[model samples]
Target: MFQSDFLRKFRILLVLVRRDYALQYAGSALGLTWMFLQNLSLVLIYTIVFYFLGIRTQGEDPLAYFAYVLSGLLFWVPLQEYLIRGTGILTDNRQLIKRSPLGPEIFLWIPFIQFLLHWAITAVPILAFLLWAGKLGGIGLPISFLCVFCTGLFVACLQSYLARINIILRDISPLVRLMTQFLFWGLPILYESKGILGKLNLLNPLFYPLETFRSFLLSGYESKAAFTDFLPFLILFLAIFFLSRARLNQIVLDHL
Candidate 1:
């Protein structure tokens, strides 16, 4: 009975994800193509500005530098979308929570699925580019994806807490947006990772996964340090998830 019920819920979640995806791009002139276009445009703009300014990674040719930036954005974009879009997810879906038999956790999956879809779509050209540049590796891709999945799980746990808080505060959504912008500049996205930023990379929660993804794509090798750095986050995620699971339903009911 439990297995059947779980399967039933999974089907419903897929429906919700598909509907949300369609609705998001419904009125856009370019529709889903805009997703690719937007990412490409940003890459081009950043590459032009940085290249003209004579910023180059040591020993890396121009193509490698461009790949580094592009690879970094691959992880960054999805991470950014997850946090910003998920901030008010529960509040945004209050009606569904009130009416639907599905768990409130289903709302969290919607944004994650959307972000993954966007990332998958954007990765096609990136993967092709890496292959053409002779930088793609067989083992690196799978390992990089595993790291990304772990990072997503970590984000989901924290987002669960934030989503619950946002219901009462109402200010969290804007704050998260502002914070992500600051993080974008603070992270080693445009500049080469060296000096103080390189030292801090070991400590910054976002740096490991970003570098893991970037390094794997650019050099066909994953960073052992990144895997090690993620252990703390994994521990934190488990603690938060266990603590919050019991109380989350109650909080939602009180807020609704």
Candidate 2:
């Protein structure tokens, strides 16, 4: 019974994913090209600033520094977009949720899959640049890539859970934006994690995943230390997933 239900919902998720992709760029002058344009502009601006400020990594080469920052930006951008958009998935689609036969969980998956598609599209240029610039060393590509995937999944599930609660209390929506802004600085996206890990920086879970990603991609070195750091995040994600699933129906019904 559960398997049939899961498949039905998964099919609905795929349909919603298609709908979101179309709606996002439908009728725009530039269409889907805007995705690339936006990312390119942001990359150029950040690259220039970091270059002028002599923000190169300590042990990694200059090209590697660019690759590091770019990779993190790639993942971070999608994660942020998903969180922001997913926060309103239920509220914005309240009518559909109330009237359609589609499960609420399907609506929750739509933004995540849409953001994942965007992430994949954005990664093409980044990977090409890394290869051309010879910044990618084979040290921890697989592990780092896995970590990136995990981060995306973890963020998606976390956002879905948060969105449900946010609907119950509208105040959480703004609070989420505020928290994400603070976290952007707290994470070691532009700087080395070693410089700020010992103090209050430990409070942000984003730090470890960002650092682990950069360590493997930019430095071409794999320290067991990096993987060790992600253990806590893994546990936290699992706990949240189970707890959220347990109350999933109740939350949806209450909001409706």
Candidate 3:
């Protein structure tokens, strides 16, 4: 039933994913080169800005700050893109949804596939830097690599539900932006969660997964809290998805 309902459109979905991915960089001379440079600029900007302030990532290590920021981006960038793009999937593709027989859920998956592609491409430099620094092996590469996509999938599912809800409440778009701004500062992406941020980290859903990636990839810090603390949120989203999915599909196309 699940396959029939969702996976039936797999081929069409892949075509859409490919089209969108290509269109994303369309008209740009450098194309994906610009994307790599953008990622590198982010690392360089943070590294230089923080150096002046004497902000040590975990210790006196030099590349620790770069690795810390890069690992956090591995999760946050994809999740943020999912949140912002997925929220508007229905509205953005209203005409396409109107014409296609596929469910609105398929539209949600497009940005996800895009996220995965972007992450994999952008990560090449970070991986090379880590390999050069000899911190690559300490990262639990295979497991952490798996976690990255799984995290993308988990966030995608949750955001798909949000995409539907945003259709009903148009104000949700701005609210999501505001909330993510709060979350961006709240999550220890550019900095470690210490003192106030550490205590308040429990309130932000993105914290655990972001921290889990950072812990393994950057600091060799391992904790079961990623599972224990983060599982409930995932389960809650799955529950919401299951409960509302059918109704959403039935109304979404017509409403859009």
Candidate whose lDDT is highest = 1
What's the TM-score of each model vs. the native? 0.86, 0.82, 0.84
**Which portions of model 1 miss their true places by more than 4 Å?**
1-3, 50-54, 57-60, 220-228
Question: Positional deviation of 181 in candidate 1, in angstroms?
Answer: 2.9
Off by over 4 Å in 2: 1-9, 52-61, 139-145, 197-201, 223-229
In candidate 2, list every pair of residues with a backbone clash: none
Please give, for residues 119-189, the per-residue lDDT of candidate 3 as tens digits: 77667777777777666646457767777787887776678778888777764888778877897887877
Write one digit per residue (lDDT tens) for candidate 1, span 1-256. 9999889877887898777667668988887788788877865676675444446656567676667677777778878888987877778777878888766788878777777776776677677777787777666567667767767877888788778778767648888998788778767777666788767666666776777776656665445345667689678877887677777767766776
Q: Quantify all predictions' global Cα lDDT against the true fold.
A: 0.73, 0.72, 0.71
Model 2 TM-score, all chains together: 0.82
Give the count of colliding residue pairs in each prediction.
0, 0, 0
- Return the top candidate by TM-score: 1
> How far does residue 77 in candidate 3 sit from its true spot (Å)?
1.8
TM-score (C-alpha) between model 1 and the true structure: 0.86
- The TM-score, computed over Cα atoms with residue i paired to residue i, of candidate 3 is 0.84
Tell me how far candidate 1 lies from the true structure as C-alpha RMSD in angstroms: 2.6
